[model samples]
Target: MEHADEVYDVIVVGAGIEGSSTAYNLAKFGKRTLLLEQFPLPHSRGSSHGQSRITRKAYGSRDFYTQMMAEAFAMTDELQKECGEQLFINCGCLVIGPRTADFLSKTKSCLKRYGIPHDQFDIYEQRKRFPALSFRDDFEFVLDKSGGLLRSDKILQAFQRQFVRYGGVLCDGEPMIDLYPGTIVSVKTTKGLHRARSVVLTLGPWAAKFLPRLGLNVPLQPLKITVCYWKEKHGGNFNIENFPTFTMNGAAGKHHIYGLPACEYPGLVKICLHHGPNIDPDNRDGVENDWVLDAMKLIIATHFPSLEKEPSIVETCIYTNTPDEDFVLDVHPTWKNIVIGAGFSGHGFKLAPVVGKVLGELATGQKPSYDLSHFKINRFFKTKL
Candidate 1:
């Protein structure tokens, strides 16, 4: 490990999608950037190591995210061209829910407002178009042509590669132990101490450990989500070539149920409950609770009769959620040189590019390109840190 005495322009802790994207942007802009990762590259311990994530501009109430998706998609395209490899596969998406559901209405309105091409399918049309899907008679479906699946693991790898090519230093297997906040922040890792003009903390579920040291309290809850994949009763019925990514709003009480087409596992579709039990990130395994699995089985049996009731393969991932389920993207309260990007709330992977850019801008003392008032930390607290 090269522990140089020189101060870096920016040091990004956590080499997940958000941190990697920020490092790429900082390095591209000619900043001396260093990315620190707790685990080795391409590990499944973090949220960014998934095979696929839904990328869409069909946000329900969050129109800012919809607007940001325009740039996010563009950045994805730019990265794809630069890497000469496909990162996103546009297989379309279906947003299905009750007609009276506010999320459905808001999503449809948001899509129309942004001039994104979309279509609404009634019960008869939906049945004719997707014969395998079983929904209530009053349920509605919206087809978002621009939405699809993003290869999350591939995107993370591409971003890390491009960041290195652009002159960014990446230190894997080096966990940040402490932070000495100041104009020039001192980042103490397990191996050595590194100094940076600014620090960006993109810690996923481990933000709670470092936020208090920085004298900030953000209501962040880390959840252990159950990623369940069910086998198709008939072969090739729910494969990527035929089925589109989908979400059922208000499916199981307060939470939404989402699923991706079968791609990672042959003949098995990835369907999961959007919410899960709270658990520690370090002790994520064997933390008791199977409510999510039970709910998945019920939903699949009720709405997706073509799929098997039992999950063929079950996995786990973590989601750090905020109170309002939005993101926290702002500079630290007391430390101006420290910026934080947290509380992704399960929907952050799609916006990693723009999120990284915003974090980089904040770290470099540059004005953010987008309106971030919705993501400010003050929304959670009245007094300034």
Candidate 2:
């Protein structure tokens, strides 16, 4: 027998979007799943809180992600029926960078492979198509027509609700104290000890802390990123109707810049850099991020003249990044039944549905749906630790 008190087939720790999505899939697959969360139902401490997130099939180097995004794009239609709410906004996502930039070329390769209706311009003459900002000849433009914005907070709520409807047990405000791995994985939480056939750790920023005690050393860095929204001088220039989601590579040296249309707030657009300083997830406040604001202002003054130089509203989010910025979607090195889904690295939100499916498959001892060589657990050698 697995365990006398094994009440669930799979236990998912961390009820963030990733964990919630995984629990939803497990419950839908008739797995008797249990989901645990440290915080309350909806909180802004983790990576899934922001109201708007850009959803696109564009990737820099990984075409498998583009394939996964295609699958993810299809799942949104299914999510609408389950949630009964608008989940996605259909505006193009534009990638702005140098023609010779590695990220742009790699992204172009994926776009070309799928024939996703993206156009690349050698000349800086995109004012007719998108007139919000000025373009430079040195920077290349890749217009991804499939790009849009996801109602992030609403999607998170929808996944959790669907998980509950599918017969998944969710316990919030209860943190996991410890986890034991075996044929029957047992998790000790703040309230009580729970046992299941498998455990999935989607701990977000808490991954670096908890993974080590499992005897697995993962290089997951918890970063504190500032999400800023700037106001457009014109009334509706950057709104969802007139604007497109955009990504600017090499904004401030190595870090990149990304933006979404004005949906969360009325006239403010969400444009921020993909960079932040390291921080402890438990203690997220009291960090200095003024330098990020300065860099963003410079970018706006140079490129986005329609928007105000200073941000109108500001917020913060966490990113559990790997050294390579790729997600860690494999199982535990020793315990195959215990799965680890961390290191989303800020860009994992759009792929949560597929990630959850993959984690569920791994938990139930089934073959993965897509190629996972890029997400292998041992990709980062122990020496790097």
The whole-model lDDT of each prediction reads: 0.90, 0.87
Query: lDDT per residue, candidate 1, 316-361, as tens digits?
Result: 8999999999999999877889999999999999999999999999
lDDT of 2 by residue, 1-385 (tens): 6555456999999999899989999999888999999998788989999788998997867778888998898887799887889998888888888777898888898888788888787543677666777756677788889988898899999999999999889899999999888888889988989998899999999999988898778889998898999998987778788778988887645458999988888998899888888899988887777888888888888888999878999899999999998899988878888899999998999999999999999999999998888888788995532
**Model 2 clash tally, residue pairs:** 0
Worst 10 residues of 1 by lDDT: 247-256
TM-score of each: 0.97, 0.95
Model 2, CA-based lDDT: 0.87
At residue 272, candidate 2 shows an lDDT of 89
Q: Model 2 misses residue 196 by how many Å?
A: 0.5
RMSD to the true structure for each prediction, in A, is: 1.9, 2.1
Evaluated at residue 133, the lDDT of candidate 2 is: 77
